[model samples]
Target: MKTLLLAESHPPTLEHLTGLLSQAGYTVRAVSDAVMALEHFSADNPDVVVLGVDLPRVDGQHVVHLIRGHSQG
Candidate 1:
């Protein structure tokens, strides 16, 4: 089974997306904050990540950079 890391700040969007992904058979981890999202990404090492551009603490672009950096190092 594939894993998905979902970083969405809005509650409704998060719920909706989570439901859809779960129904599709992906193991999903949903987070409202970018920090938690990154933490989960490191721990889960998800096959795919769905991020909201507007996020708290850290934004989506920065998170992508972080992921890239971590992958390289």
Candidate 2:
């Protein structure tokens, strides 16, 4: 099964997206903050990442950079 790393600050959006993606058959790991998102990304190494631009603690763009830096792909 494929996995998705979802980093969204809005609670409703997060819940909605998680449900939608889960129904679509992807394993979703959702986080409300960028720091936790990055941590989860490192631990889970998800196949895809869905990020909210406006994030707390760190920001989506930085998280993307971190992922790119660590990822072989």
Candidate 3:
């Protein structure tokens, strides 16, 4: 399965998440901000998006709403 991670800009955690997902045999796409997350969503079309709530520019709840809207409509 594919996983898209919208994680904090902290490098260590981001690296760890990527490593873990890769080890789990997932096709992982990791992005720091919400804009890139949306871009990845359109480009990668991941099966799941793991979003961080304290996101910059656009927050996670808004992302969730947008994804839901896109999925439904």
TM-scores of the candidates are: 0.95, 0.94, 0.86
Candidates ranked by TM-score:
1, 2, 3
On the 0 to 100 scale, the lDDT of residue 13 in model 3 is: 75
Q: Against the correct fold, how does model 2 do in TM-score?
A: 0.94
The C-alpha lDDT values of all candidates are 0.95, 0.94, 0.77
Cα miss at 4, model 3 (Å)?
Answer: 3.4
Identify the runs in model 2 with alpha carbons over 4 angstroms from their true place: none
Write the residue-wise lDDT of candidate 2 on 1-73 in tens digits: 8999999999999999999999999999999999999889888989999999999998889888989989866
Off by over 4 Å in 1: none
Q: In what order do the candidates fall by lDDT, top score first?
A: 1, 2, 3
Best of the two (1, 3) by lDDT: 1
Worst 10 residues of 1 by lDDT: 37-46
lDDT tens digits, residue span 1-73, model 1: 9999999999999999999999999999999999999999899899999999999999999999999999899
Location of the lowest summed lDDT over 10 successive residues in candidate 2 = 64-73
Ten consecutive residues with minimal summed lDDT in candidate 3? 1-10
Model 3 lDDT tens row, 25-72 = 887788887788877887777887888877788997898888889878
